[model samples]
Target: MLNQIPLEHILLLSAVLFSLGILAVITKRHAVVVLMGIELIFNAANLNLVAFSRHDPQLMQGQLFSLFVIIIAAAEAAVALAIVLRVYQHFNTANLNQIVTSED
Candidate 1:
């Protein structure tokens, strides 16, 4: 069933996901939303990797790389969320623009 779908279609979907992720990251101010955008970008890359890997089932390099990316993304989310929590405790807000530091 997967072979019937053209690579171009999968690539197009991935591109759209990437674009949306970029837009979210650039336009949203909430830290959680930004993290979600980052996840979207990671997912887009994973989709491309898996799509290409489907063509050659023997090598499986793309799938392996995608798995690594997933692991890194999970760790990143944990660390980033922890940082965001600390920032919120200090600033009382999660909006990036609203968080400011005193020079003193």
Candidate 2:
């Protein structure tokens, strides 16, 4: 079923998602929302990797790389969430702008 659809369309969708992720990361001030934007960007890359790998069945390089990316992203999210929790405990706010003003 996927073979019928052109690769260009898949790539175009990934590109659009990547653009929106960038916008969210840039415009949003909340820490968790920014983290979600980062996840979106990672997912966009994962989509491209799977799309490209679909043509080559012998070597699943793209799929393997995408799996590694997913693992790393999970670990990153866990550590970042821990840090955000600590920051919130100290500053009493999760907003990025407020985090910058805290002296100690």
Candidate 3:
């Protein structure tokens, strides 16, 4: 039943998600929120990759690529969160703007 859906629909959904992620990353000032936005962007790509993979019965390339992307995103998130944590400890704030202005 899933294969009956047109690729356009999936692509459209991915586009919207990707756009929202861009907006969040651009507007948010909090470290964690910006990280969430980055994750959203990753998820949007993953969705498109898996969706395209589903279109082919024998081709698993897209799925494999998405898995690699997922692993990379996980590692990026962990490292970013750790950096954010250290920033918070040193600056006593999670707000990006505040952290920037307070730096002497």
Candidates arranged by lDDT, highest first: 3, 1, 2
Alpha-carbon TM-score of each model against the true structure:
0.91, 0.92, 0.92
Give the per-residue lDDT digits (tens) of candidate 3, residues 1-104. 44477889989999998999999999999999999999999999999999989979699999999999999999999999999999999999999999999945
lDDT of 2 by residue, 1-104 (tens): 44466899999999998998999999999999999999999999999999999889898999999999999999999999999899889899999998898787
Q: For model 2, what is the C-alpha lDDT against the true structure? A: 0.93
Off by over 4 Å in 2: 1-3
lDDT of 1 by residue, 12-103 (tens): 99999999999999999999999999999999999999999988989999999999999999999999999999988988889887875432
Residue 2 lDDT in model 3?
41
Backbone clashes in model 1, listed as residue pairs: none
In candidate 1, clashing pairs total 0
Cα error, residue 30 of model 2, in Å, equals 0.3
Error of 3 at 83 (Å): 0.6
